[model samples]
Target: MTAKLADKYGPWGVVAGGSDGVGAAFAHRIAAAGINVVLVARRVPVLEACADEIRAEHGVDVRTVALDLSASDAVARLVDATADVEVGLFVYNAGADDISVPFLDKDVDTHLSLVRRNCGAVLEAAYRFGGPMVERERGGVVLVTSGAAWAGGASLAAYGATKAFDLVLAESLWAEWRGHNVDVLSLVLGMTDTPSLRRTLAAKGDAAPDGIATPDDVAETALRHLGDGPTWIHGAGDPTGPSPLGALPRRDAVLAMSRSWAEE
Candidate 1:
Protein backbone atom coordinates (compact mmCIF):
# COMPACT_ATOMS: atom_id res chain seq x y z
CA MET A 1 0.00 0.00 0.00
CA THR A 2 1.14 3.49 -0.74
CA ALA A 3 1.59 6.29 1.81
CA LYS A 4 -1.37 8.24 0.48
CA LEU A 5 -3.31 7.04 3.51
CA ALA A 6 -1.06 9.19 5.64
CA ASP A 7 -1.86 12.24 3.62
CA LYS A 8 -5.58 11.48 3.68
CA TYR A 9 -5.40 11.21 7.45
CA GLY A 10 -2.26 13.05 8.23
CA PRO A 11 -0.52 14.82 11.13
CA TRP A 12 -0.47 11.86 13.57
CA GLY A 13 -1.66 8.34 14.31
CA VAL A 14 -2.21 6.56 17.60
CA VAL A 15 -1.89 2.83 18.17
CA ALA A 16 -2.87 1.38 21.51
CA GLY A 17 -0.88 -1.65 22.68
CA GLY A 18 1.70 -0.62 20.12
CA SER A 19 4.86 -1.93 21.75
CA ASP A 20 5.11 -5.13 19.68
CA GLY A 21 3.28 -7.60 17.54
CA VAL A 22 0.55 -6.23 15.31
CA GLY A 23 0.46 -2.90 17.13
CA ALA A 24 4.16 -2.26 16.61
CA ALA A 25 3.87 -3.23 12.97
CA PHE A 26 1.11 -0.66 12.55
CA ALA A 27 3.27 2.01 14.17
CA HIS A 28 6.11 1.22 11.81
CA ARG A 29 3.94 1.28 8.69
CA ILE A 30 2.18 4.51 9.67
CA ALA A 31 5.48 6.19 10.47
CA ALA A 32 6.88 5.02 7.17
CA ALA A 33 4.16 7.10 5.57
CA GLY A 34 5.70 10.15 7.27
CA ILE A 35 2.95 10.45 9.81
CA ASN A 36 4.12 11.03 13.38
CA VAL A 37 2.96 8.21 15.62
CA VAL A 38 1.96 7.91 19.26
CA LEU A 39 2.39 4.39 20.58
CA VAL A 40 0.72 3.43 23.85
CA ALA A 41 1.55 0.31 25.78
CA ARG A 42 1.97 -0.86 29.37
CA ARG A 43 5.69 -1.62 29.53
CA VAL A 44 7.79 1.52 29.38
CA PRO A 45 10.82 -0.27 27.97
CA VAL A 46 8.93 -2.01 25.19
CA LEU A 47 7.07 1.18 24.35
CA GLU A 48 10.27 3.20 24.21
CA ALA A 49 12.08 0.55 22.23
CA CYS A 50 9.31 0.44 19.65
CA ALA A 51 9.23 4.23 19.46
CA ASP A 52 12.99 4.41 19.00
CA GLU A 53 12.86 1.79 16.27
CA ILE A 54 10.14 3.67 14.44
CA ARG A 55 12.26 6.81 14.59
CA ALA A 56 15.37 4.98 13.46
CA GLU A 57 13.69 3.05 10.69
CA HIS A 58 10.91 5.31 9.48
CA GLY A 59 12.38 8.56 10.83
CA VAL A 60 8.98 9.95 11.75
CA ASP A 61 8.37 11.65 15.08
CA VAL A 62 7.45 9.09 17.71
CA ARG A 63 5.93 9.45 21.16
CA THR A 64 5.57 6.68 23.69
CA VAL A 65 2.99 6.59 26.45
CA ALA A 66 3.16 3.90 29.08
CA LEU A 67 -0.32 3.24 30.32
CA ASP A 68 -2.41 0.17 31.04
CA LEU A 69 -5.40 0.31 28.74
CA SER A 70 -7.26 -1.84 31.24
CA ALA A 71 -7.08 0.90 33.80
CA SER A 72 -9.97 3.33 34.24
CA ASP A 73 -7.82 6.38 33.57
CA ALA A 74 -6.15 5.03 30.42
CA VAL A 75 -8.03 7.03 27.79
CA ALA A 76 -7.97 10.13 29.96
CA ARG A 77 -4.19 9.92 30.29
CA LEU A 78 -3.88 9.24 26.54
CA VAL A 79 -6.01 12.27 25.74
CA ASP A 80 -3.91 14.41 28.06
CA ALA A 81 -0.66 13.05 26.65
CA THR A 82 -1.52 13.77 23.00
CA ALA A 83 -3.83 16.71 23.49
CA ASP A 84 -1.76 18.96 21.25
CA VAL A 85 -1.11 16.43 18.49
CA GLU A 86 -3.60 16.07 15.70
CA VAL A 87 -4.31 12.34 15.75
CA GLY A 88 -5.93 11.58 12.41
CA LEU A 89 -5.89 7.82 12.78
CA PHE A 90 -6.66 5.77 15.87
CA VAL A 91 -6.21 1.97 15.95
CA TYR A 92 -7.53 0.26 19.07
CA ASN A 93 -5.44 -2.92 19.16
CA ALA A 94 -4.95 -3.63 22.88
CA GLY A 95 -7.54 -6.36 23.49
CA ALA A 96 -5.41 -9.45 23.84
CA ASP A 97 -6.41 -12.09 26.43
CA ASP A 98 -3.67 -14.61 27.12
CA ILE A 99 -5.83 -17.07 29.00
CA SER A 100 -8.77 -18.84 27.42
CA VAL A 101 -10.12 -20.88 30.27
CA PRO A 102 -13.74 -21.55 31.05
CA PHE A 103 -15.88 -18.59 31.96
CA LEU A 104 -16.07 -19.29 35.68
CA ASP A 105 -12.41 -20.31 35.87
CA LYS A 106 -11.62 -16.60 36.12
CA ASP A 107 -12.90 -14.26 38.78
CA VAL A 108 -15.44 -11.51 38.18
CA ASP A 109 -12.89 -8.71 38.32
CA THR A 110 -10.70 -10.31 35.70
CA HIS A 111 -13.56 -10.55 33.27
CA LEU A 112 -14.65 -7.02 34.14
CA SER A 113 -11.17 -5.72 33.51
CA LEU A 114 -11.13 -7.22 30.03
CA VAL A 115 -14.56 -5.78 29.37
CA ARG A 116 -13.48 -2.31 30.46
CA ARG A 117 -10.36 -2.39 28.35
CA ASN A 118 -11.94 -3.96 25.26
CA CYS A 119 -15.13 -1.96 25.34
CA GLY A 120 -15.04 1.06 27.61
CA ALA A 121 -11.61 2.38 26.70
CA VAL A 122 -12.22 1.67 23.02
CA LEU A 123 -15.42 3.70 23.18
CA GLU A 124 -13.65 6.54 24.94
CA ALA A 125 -10.86 6.62 22.38
CA ALA A 126 -13.36 6.78 19.54
CA TYR A 127 -15.22 9.61 21.20
CA ARG A 128 -12.15 11.64 22.15
CA PHE A 129 -10.07 11.12 19.01
CA GLY A 130 -12.77 10.42 16.45
CA GLY A 131 -14.61 13.59 17.44
CA PRO A 132 -11.88 15.66 15.88
CA MET A 133 -11.81 13.53 12.74
CA VAL A 134 -15.47 14.23 12.28
CA GLU A 135 -14.89 17.92 12.85
CA ARG A 136 -12.07 18.00 10.31
CA GLU A 137 -14.12 15.89 7.90
CA ARG A 138 -11.33 13.31 7.59
CA GLY A 139 -9.45 10.65 9.58
CA GLY A 140 -9.82 6.91 10.25
CA VAL A 141 -10.40 4.34 12.98
CA VAL A 142 -9.39 0.68 12.87
CA LEU A 143 -10.76 -1.64 15.53
CA VAL A 144 -8.90 -4.93 15.66
CA THR A 145 -11.34 -7.72 16.25
CA SER A 146 -11.21 -11.52 16.00
CA GLY A 147 -12.97 -14.39 14.24
CA ALA A 148 -13.93 -15.48 17.72
CA ALA A 149 -16.59 -12.82 17.45
CA TRP A 150 -18.33 -14.78 14.73
CA ALA A 151 -19.52 -17.44 17.12
CA GLY A 152 -19.56 -18.31 20.80
CA GLY A 153 -16.94 -20.85 21.78
CA ALA A 154 -16.34 -22.97 24.84
CA SER A 155 -13.27 -21.06 26.07
CA LEU A 156 -14.02 -17.72 24.40
CA ALA A 157 -16.73 -16.24 26.52
CA ALA A 158 -15.43 -12.87 27.62
CA TYR A 159 -12.79 -12.55 24.94
CA GLY A 160 -15.13 -13.39 22.09
CA ALA A 161 -17.84 -11.19 23.53
CA THR A 162 -15.51 -8.24 23.72
CA LYS A 163 -14.32 -8.87 20.17
CA ALA A 164 -17.90 -8.90 19.04
CA PHE A 165 -18.29 -5.58 20.78
CA ASP A 166 -15.34 -4.18 18.85
CA LEU A 167 -16.61 -5.51 15.51
CA VAL A 168 -20.05 -3.97 16.05
CA LEU A 169 -18.59 -0.72 17.28
CA ALA A 170 -16.34 -0.44 14.25
CA GLU A 171 -19.11 -1.29 11.80
CA SER A 172 -21.54 1.12 13.42
CA LEU A 173 -18.99 3.88 13.39
CA TRP A 174 -18.21 3.11 9.78
CA ALA A 175 -21.84 3.56 8.92
CA GLU A 176 -22.15 6.80 10.82
CA TRP A 177 -18.89 8.33 9.60
CA ARG A 178 -18.89 7.23 5.98
CA GLY A 179 -20.81 10.28 4.87
CA HIS A 180 -18.56 12.48 6.98
CA ASN A 181 -15.44 11.27 5.10
CA VAL A 182 -14.08 9.41 8.13
CA ASP A 183 -13.07 5.81 7.47
CA VAL A 184 -13.74 3.09 10.02
CA LEU A 185 -12.63 -0.49 9.56
CA SER A 186 -13.31 -3.50 11.71
CA LEU A 187 -10.28 -5.70 11.02
CA VAL A 188 -11.23 -9.25 11.90
CA LEU A 189 -8.38 -11.61 12.59
CA GLY A 190 -7.87 -15.32 13.12
CA MET A 191 -4.85 -17.08 14.66
CA THR A 192 -1.79 -14.87 14.33
CA ASP A 193 1.78 -15.38 15.50
CA THR A 194 1.78 -12.55 17.99
CA PRO A 195 3.58 -12.62 21.33
CA SER A 196 0.22 -12.52 23.03
CA LEU A 197 -0.94 -15.48 20.94
CA ARG A 198 2.17 -17.48 21.72
CA ARG A 199 1.64 -16.89 25.43
CA THR A 200 -1.97 -17.95 25.14
CA LEU A 201 -1.11 -21.10 23.25
CA ALA A 202 1.60 -21.93 25.75
CA ALA A 203 -0.84 -21.44 28.59
CA LYS A 204 -3.22 -23.85 26.86
CA GLY A 205 -0.47 -26.44 26.27
CA ASP A 206 -0.97 -26.23 22.51
CA ALA A 207 2.42 -25.57 20.95
CA ALA A 208 1.82 -27.45 17.74
CA PRO A 209 2.26 -25.48 14.57
CA ASP A 210 -0.81 -24.18 12.84
CA GLY A 211 -1.59 -21.73 10.07
CA ILE A 212 -1.02 -18.41 11.79
CA ALA A 213 -0.59 -14.94 10.34
CA THR A 214 2.39 -12.73 10.96
CA PRO A 215 1.96 -9.37 12.61
CA ASP A 216 3.58 -7.59 9.68
CA ASP A 217 1.10 -9.12 7.22
CA VAL A 218 -1.85 -8.27 9.40
CA ALA A 219 -0.73 -4.68 9.86
CA GLU A 220 0.01 -4.19 6.19
CA THR A 221 -3.34 -5.59 5.10
CA ALA A 222 -5.27 -3.49 7.62
CA LEU A 223 -3.50 -0.24 6.79
CA ARG A 224 -3.98 -0.80 3.08
CA HIS A 225 -7.70 -1.25 3.54
CA LEU A 226 -8.42 1.29 6.24
CA GLY A 227 -10.80 2.92 3.83
CA ASP A 228 -12.61 -0.35 3.17
CA GLY A 229 -14.99 0.30 5.99
CA PRO A 230 -17.46 -2.06 7.70
CA THR A 231 -14.90 -4.87 7.75
CA TRP A 232 -11.64 -6.22 6.39
CA ILE A 233 -11.25 -9.86 7.30
CA HIS A 234 -7.64 -10.95 7.10
CA GLY A 235 -7.07 -13.70 4.52
CA ALA A 236 -10.64 -14.16 3.52
CA GLY A 237 -11.92 -14.79 -0.02
CA ASP A 238 -14.52 -12.11 0.44
CA PRO A 239 -13.44 -9.62 3.04
CA THR A 240 -16.66 -7.64 2.97
CA GLY A 241 -19.08 -10.47 2.32
CA PRO A 242 -20.92 -12.64 4.85
CA SER A 243 -19.01 -14.52 7.51
CA PRO A 244 -17.23 -17.69 6.35
CA LEU A 245 -19.44 -19.69 8.65
CA GLY A 246 -22.59 -17.80 7.95
CA ALA A 247 -24.10 -20.54 5.83
CA LEU A 248 -23.84 -23.12 8.58
CA PRO A 249 -26.45 -23.60 11.25
CA ARG A 250 -25.87 -21.68 14.44
CA ARG A 251 -25.36 -24.84 16.48
CA ASP A 252 -23.02 -26.24 13.87
CA ALA A 253 -21.03 -23.06 13.68
CA VAL A 254 -20.69 -22.90 17.44
CA LEU A 255 -19.60 -26.53 17.63
CA ALA A 256 -17.06 -26.02 14.85
CA MET A 257 -15.68 -22.93 16.48
CA SER A 258 -15.46 -24.73 19.79
CA ARG A 259 -13.52 -27.62 18.26
CA SER A 260 -11.25 -25.31 16.25
CA TRP A 261 -10.43 -23.10 19.19
CA ALA A 262 -9.85 -26.09 21.45
CA GLU A 263 -7.53 -27.82 19.01
CA GLU A 264 -5.64 -24.65 18.13
Candidate 2:
Protein backbone atom coordinates (compact mmCIF):
# COMPACT_ATOMS: atom_id res chain seq x y z
CA MET A 1 0.00 0.00 0.00
CA THR A 2 1.12 3.55 -0.62
CA ALA A 3 2.21 5.04 2.68
CA LYS A 4 -0.20 7.50 4.30
CA LEU A 5 -0.16 9.55 7.45
CA ALA A 6 -2.98 9.79 9.94
CA ASP A 7 -4.67 13.16 9.83
CA LYS A 8 -3.54 14.01 13.32
CA TYR A 9 -1.25 16.68 11.96
CA GLY A 10 -3.75 18.26 9.67
CA PRO A 11 -6.04 21.29 10.11
CA TRP A 12 -3.03 23.60 9.88
CA GLY A 13 0.64 23.40 8.92
CA VAL A 14 3.48 25.85 8.29
CA VAL A 15 6.09 25.47 5.56
CA ALA A 16 8.96 27.87 6.01
CA GLY A 17 10.77 28.41 2.70
CA GLY A 18 7.75 26.88 1.12
CA SER A 19 8.27 28.55 -2.23
CA ASP A 20 10.98 26.18 -3.48
CA GLY A 21 12.42 22.71 -3.51
CA VAL A 22 11.47 20.29 -0.77
CA GLY A 23 9.56 22.94 1.12
CA ALA A 24 7.10 23.30 -1.75
CA ALA A 25 6.78 19.55 -1.84
CA PHE A 26 5.91 19.47 1.83
CA ALA A 27 3.31 22.16 1.34
CA HIS A 28 1.66 20.25 -1.49
CA ARG A 29 1.72 16.90 0.23
CA ILE A 30 0.35 18.20 3.48
CA ALA A 31 -2.46 19.97 1.67
CA ALA A 32 -3.20 16.79 -0.25
CA ALA A 33 -3.44 14.98 3.07
CA GLY A 34 -6.22 17.36 4.15
CA ILE A 35 -4.20 20.06 5.85
CA ASN A 36 -4.41 23.83 5.66
CA VAL A 37 -0.99 25.18 4.72
CA VAL A 38 0.74 28.48 5.41
CA LEU A 39 3.72 29.12 3.14
CA VAL A 40 6.52 31.52 4.07
CA ALA A 41 9.24 32.68 1.67
CA ARG A 42 10.95 35.74 0.32
CA ARG A 43 9.29 35.64 -3.07
CA VAL A 44 5.63 36.49 -3.35
CA PRO A 45 4.93 35.20 -6.83
CA VAL A 46 6.47 31.81 -6.20
CA LEU A 47 4.84 31.49 -2.80
CA GLU A 48 1.45 32.47 -4.19
CA ALA A 49 1.89 30.06 -7.07
CA CYS A 50 2.59 27.15 -4.77
CA ALA A 51 -0.33 28.00 -2.53
CA ASP A 52 -2.60 28.35 -5.53
CA GLU A 53 -1.54 25.00 -6.91
CA ILE A 54 -2.12 23.21 -3.64
CA ARG A 55 -5.46 24.88 -3.12
CA ALA A 56 -6.58 23.95 -6.61
CA GLU A 57 -5.45 20.38 -6.35
CA HIS A 58 -6.51 19.55 -2.80
CA GLY A 59 -9.26 22.12 -2.13
CA VAL A 60 -7.54 23.07 1.13
CA ASP A 61 -6.85 26.49 2.55
CA VAL A 62 -3.46 27.91 1.59
CA ARG A 63 -1.83 31.11 2.87
CA THR A 64 1.38 32.85 1.88
CA VAL A 65 3.77 35.31 3.50
CA ALA A 66 6.72 36.77 1.63
CA LEU A 67 9.62 37.61 3.92
CA ASP A 68 13.32 36.92 4.03
CA LEU A 69 13.92 34.83 7.11
CA SER A 70 17.51 35.97 7.35
CA ALA A 71 16.46 39.50 8.17
CA SER A 72 17.11 40.74 11.70
CA ASP A 73 13.48 40.58 12.84
CA ALA A 74 12.40 37.60 10.81
CA VAL A 75 11.06 35.52 13.65
CA ALA A 76 9.09 38.37 15.11
CA ARG A 77 7.76 39.17 11.68
CA LEU A 78 6.85 35.57 11.07
CA VAL A 79 5.04 35.40 14.39
CA ASP A 80 3.15 38.54 13.55
CA ALA A 81 2.21 37.24 10.14
CA THR A 82 1.01 33.92 11.52
CA ALA A 83 -0.50 35.23 14.72
CA ASP A 84 -3.98 34.05 13.88
CA VAL A 85 -3.01 30.49 12.95
CA GLU A 86 -2.54 27.30 14.89
CA VAL A 87 0.13 25.19 13.26
CA GLY A 88 0.13 21.43 13.74
CA LEU A 89 3.21 20.84 11.66
CA PHE A 90 6.19 23.15 11.22
CA VAL A 91 8.78 22.50 8.51
CA TYR A 92 11.97 24.56 8.54
CA ASN A 93 13.36 23.91 5.06
CA ALA A 94 14.87 27.26 4.09
CA GLY A 95 18.67 27.58 4.04
CA ALA A 96 21.61 28.74 1.92
CA ASP A 97 25.19 27.74 1.18
CA ASP A 98 28.05 30.20 1.01
CA ILE A 99 29.71 30.81 -2.34
CA SER A 100 31.83 27.68 -2.88
CA VAL A 101 35.10 29.62 -2.80
CA PRO A 102 38.02 28.87 -0.53
CA PHE A 103 37.19 30.07 2.99
CA LEU A 104 39.79 32.84 2.88
CA ASP A 105 38.65 33.96 -0.55
CA LYS A 106 35.02 34.46 0.56
CA ASP A 107 33.81 37.92 1.45
CA VAL A 108 32.52 38.76 4.93
CA ASP A 109 29.02 39.47 3.62
CA THR A 110 28.62 36.02 2.08
CA HIS A 111 29.83 34.36 5.27
CA LEU A 112 27.46 36.38 7.43
CA SER A 113 24.55 35.63 5.10
CA LEU A 114 25.21 31.93 5.38
CA VAL A 115 25.29 32.05 9.18
CA ARG A 116 22.15 34.15 9.45
CA ARG A 117 20.26 32.10 6.92
CA ASN A 118 21.23 28.68 8.17
CA CYS A 119 21.65 29.17 11.89
CA GLY A 120 20.03 32.42 12.99
CA ALA A 121 16.84 32.12 11.02
CA VAL A 122 16.31 28.49 11.86
CA LEU A 123 16.84 29.04 15.58
CA GLU A 124 14.59 32.05 15.68
CA ALA A 125 11.73 30.38 13.83
CA ALA A 126 11.98 27.30 15.98
CA TYR A 127 11.72 29.16 19.25
CA ARG A 128 8.88 31.38 18.15
CA PHE A 129 6.71 28.67 16.58
CA GLY A 130 7.95 25.82 18.72
CA GLY A 131 6.99 27.43 21.99
CA PRO A 132 3.39 27.86 20.91
CA MET A 133 3.17 24.28 19.67
CA VAL A 134 4.39 23.05 23.02
CA GLU A 135 1.84 25.13 24.88
CA ARG A 136 -0.85 23.53 22.78
CA GLU A 137 0.55 20.10 23.69
CA ARG A 138 0.56 18.65 20.18
CA GLY A 139 2.57 19.26 17.05
CA GLY A 140 5.51 18.10 14.95
CA VAL A 141 8.61 19.90 13.68
CA VAL A 142 11.00 18.94 10.90
CA LEU A 143 14.35 20.63 10.39
CA VAL A 144 15.88 20.06 6.96
CA THR A 145 19.50 19.60 7.84
CA SER A 146 21.81 17.99 5.28
CA GLY A 147 23.73 14.70 5.26
CA ALA A 148 26.77 16.97 4.96
CA ALA A 149 26.27 17.42 8.71
CA TRP A 150 28.27 14.23 9.06
CA ALA A 151 31.71 15.47 8.13
CA GLY A 152 33.93 18.47 7.60
CA GLY A 153 34.83 18.88 3.94
CA ALA A 154 36.94 21.53 2.26
CA SER A 155 34.41 22.50 -0.40
CA LEU A 156 31.43 22.31 1.96
CA ALA A 157 33.00 23.54 5.17
CA ALA A 158 30.63 26.39 5.95
CA TYR A 159 27.53 24.58 4.74
CA GLY A 160 28.43 21.43 6.62
CA ALA A 161 29.08 23.33 9.83
CA THR A 162 25.74 25.11 9.61
CA LYS A 163 23.92 21.85 8.91
CA ALA A 164 25.67 20.26 11.87
CA PHE A 165 24.30 23.05 14.00
CA ASP A 166 20.82 22.37 12.63
CA LEU A 167 21.11 18.70 13.55
CA VAL A 168 22.09 19.39 17.12
CA LEU A 169 19.49 22.11 17.45
CA ALA A 170 16.69 19.79 16.42
CA GLU A 171 17.86 17.12 18.81
CA SER A 172 18.15 19.48 21.73
CA LEU A 173 14.74 20.99 21.10
CA TRP A 174 13.23 17.54 20.80
CA ALA A 175 14.58 16.54 24.19
CA GLU A 176 13.41 19.70 25.84
CA TRP A 177 9.90 19.51 24.41
CA ARG A 178 9.23 15.79 24.64
CA GLY A 179 7.08 16.16 27.71
CA HIS A 180 4.89 18.71 25.99
CA ASN A 181 3.94 16.24 23.24
CA VAL A 182 5.82 18.09 20.53
CA ASP A 183 7.70 15.89 18.10
CA VAL A 184 10.99 17.18 16.70
CA LEU A 185 12.93 15.59 13.87
CA SER A 186 16.18 16.17 12.05
CA LEU A 187 15.98 15.20 8.40
CA VAL A 188 19.60 14.50 7.37
CA LEU A 189 18.58 14.60 3.79
CA GLY A 190 20.70 13.10 1.03
CA MET A 191 20.85 14.60 -2.42
CA THR A 192 17.44 15.07 -3.95
CA ASP A 193 16.22 16.17 -7.37
CA THR A 194 15.29 19.83 -6.90
CA PRO A 195 15.71 23.01 -8.88
CA SER A 196 18.06 24.51 -6.31
CA LEU A 197 20.29 21.45 -6.37
CA ARG A 198 20.33 21.49 -10.13
CA ARG A 199 21.26 25.17 -10.25
CA THR A 200 23.92 24.84 -7.60
CA LEU A 201 25.53 21.85 -9.26
CA ALA A 202 25.32 23.34 -12.72
CA ALA A 203 26.99 26.54 -11.52
CA LYS A 204 29.81 24.42 -10.13
CA GLY A 205 30.13 22.66 -13.54
CA ASP A 206 28.63 19.50 -12.13
CA ALA A 207 25.82 17.12 -13.08
CA ALA A 208 22.83 15.98 -11.08
CA PRO A 209 22.62 12.58 -9.38
CA ASP A 210 21.25 9.50 -11.14
CA GLY A 211 18.77 8.39 -8.44
CA ILE A 212 17.74 11.63 -6.85
CA ALA A 213 14.33 11.75 -5.11
CA THR A 214 11.50 14.12 -5.88
CA PRO A 215 10.24 16.56 -3.29
CA ASP A 216 7.06 14.51 -2.97
CA ASP A 217 9.04 11.51 -1.77
CA VAL A 218 10.58 13.39 1.12
CA ALA A 219 7.31 15.17 1.99
CA GLU A 220 5.35 11.95 2.18
CA THR A 221 7.98 10.49 4.47
CA ALA A 222 7.82 13.54 6.71
CA LEU A 223 4.07 13.21 7.09
CA ARG A 224 4.09 9.54 7.94
CA HIS A 225 6.56 10.14 10.76
CA LEU A 226 4.90 13.22 12.22
CA GLY A 227 4.33 12.94 15.96
CA ASP A 228 6.48 9.81 16.13
CA GLY A 229 8.57 11.77 18.62
CA PRO A 230 12.15 12.95 18.44
CA THR A 231 14.05 11.29 15.60
CA TRP A 232 17.52 11.71 14.10
CA ILE A 233 18.21 11.27 10.43
CA HIS A 234 14.43 11.39 10.29
CA GLY A 235 14.37 10.88 6.56
CA ALA A 236 17.35 10.03 4.31
CA GLY A 237 18.12 8.52 0.95
CA ASP A 238 15.52 7.69 -1.69
CA PRO A 239 12.25 5.78 -1.30
CA THR A 240 14.23 2.56 -1.69
CA GLY A 241 15.81 3.06 1.69
CA PRO A 242 14.21 2.06 4.99
CA SER A 243 11.47 4.17 6.48
CA PRO A 244 12.11 6.49 9.37
CA LEU A 245 13.06 4.58 12.54
CA GLY A 246 12.68 1.29 10.70
CA ALA A 247 16.41 0.77 11.06
CA LEU A 248 19.28 2.68 12.51
CA PRO A 249 20.81 4.78 9.73
CA ARG A 250 24.57 4.95 9.32
CA ARG A 251 26.00 8.36 8.47
CA ASP A 252 28.73 6.76 6.35
CA ALA A 253 26.26 4.66 4.40
CA VAL A 254 24.45 7.70 3.07
CA LEU A 255 27.63 9.77 2.56
CA ALA A 256 29.30 7.06 0.55
CA MET A 257 26.20 6.57 -1.57
CA SER A 258 25.72 10.29 -2.24
CA ARG A 259 29.39 10.90 -2.98
CA SER A 260 29.40 8.11 -5.53
CA TRP A 261 26.54 9.74 -7.41
CA ALA A 262 27.32 13.43 -6.82
CA GLU A 263 28.26 15.60 -9.79
CA GLU A 264 31.83 15.70 -10.99
Q: What is the lDDT of candidate 1?
A: 0.91
* Model 2 accuracy (lDDT, Cα): 0.76
lDDT of 2 by residue, 142-208 (tens): 9988766766555566787898899889979988988987889877777777778888788877777
lDDT of 1 at 96: 85
Q: 40-140 in candidate 1: lDDT tens per residue? A: 99989888988988999988899989998989999999999999989999999999897888999999999999999999999999999999999999999
Where is the poorest 10-residue window by lDDT in model 2?
1-10
| Candidate 2 residue runs with Cα over 4 Å from true position | 1-7, 232-264
Residue 41 of model 1 has an lDDT of 93
TM-score of each: 0.97, 0.85
Which pairs in model 1 have colliding backbones?
none
